[model samples]
Target: LEAYQKFVFEEDRLRSVQIAHHICSLMQRGNVVVRWKLYHSVFNPVLQRGVKLAHHCQHSSVTSAQMHSCPHHDQCLPQEVLQVYLKTLPALLKS
Candidate 1:
């Protein structure tokens, strides 16, 4: 039973990590609205799953570390992506 539970937990963690990476890749392209949509559609659900799994495991630190280290955690902020988006918008809007 313990081993089965461990396998399930690891599988959930792996899925969460994969989702985070997918979010990062999507964010690297597209406009602000597109990125925000991807966040809502993709990132938030996975994040909720991770939270639930962490809560169930009663080891918040285990998931927290993985969440923090996700590339999106560092790069998901508006200030980071928006600056680049804004700079390119002028050219895009002109075309």
Candidate 2:
């Protein structure tokens, strides 16, 4: 979890996505519960940053939406961390 958080919150955009994709690949090799936990740590943060990171991934949203603050969840990094990872979050969260 600490490594995941460090990569997401401390690393640069390029490195973060690189780590995310690598992590995604590795997660597929793990059991269901392990995958779920790791994926949650990875994507839940991005889901919160969807409005911000999605635009980085070429997703659409209003200017105000990106600027909007989500105080309930901890502050997300201002940079894009996981675009591809966002693709996996919902299903894993459901599972």
Candidate 3:
């Protein structure tokens, strides 16, 4: 049981890391123009969905351990992604 629990925990952590990395990759590939278009077009809807997902994934009864791995479909972006997003904020705000 201990081994199984460890395995599950590791899997969850890996999934969370993958999600974070994916978001970072998306940001890295995105240029200022692309980011703006993304912000205007895609991000809003994604953010809305993320909010709903957060309610379920972060706040629901499910174990935090599971939630970390089985991220809500809407809550795809991770904190790392948000960090990259913030790095672009000054330029975005200037524009």
List the candidate 2 regions with Cα displacement exceeding 4 Å.
51-80, 89-95
Q: Score candidate 2 by TM-score against the native.
A: 0.55
lDDT of 3 by residue, 1-95 (tens): 22322222232545544444444355457787766555655444435544555566656665545655664533444443334444654655665
For model 1, give the RMSD to the true fold: 12.8
Per-model TM against the reference: 0.40, 0.55, 0.37
Q: Between the candidate structures 1 and 2, which one is better when assessed by TM-score?
A: 2
Screening candidate 1 with a backbone cut-off below 3 angstroms (N, C-alpha, C), the clashing residue pairs are none
Better of 2 and 3 by TM-score: 2
> What is candidate 2's lDDT per residue for 30-64, written digit by digit as tens?
78887868757865665667654444435333243
Tell me, by lDDT, which candidate is best.
2
**Cα RMSD to the true fold for all candidates:** 12.8, 6.5, 10.3
In candidate 3 the C-alpha lDDT for residue 10 amounts to 36
Per-residue accuracy of model 1 over 3-81 as CA lDDT, tens digit each: 3222322435454344444445555566788666755665444445444554543543434446545444432222222
Please report, in order, the local distance difference test score of every candidate based on alpha carbons: 0.43, 0.60, 0.48
| Lowest-sum lDDT 10-residue window in model 3 | 1-10
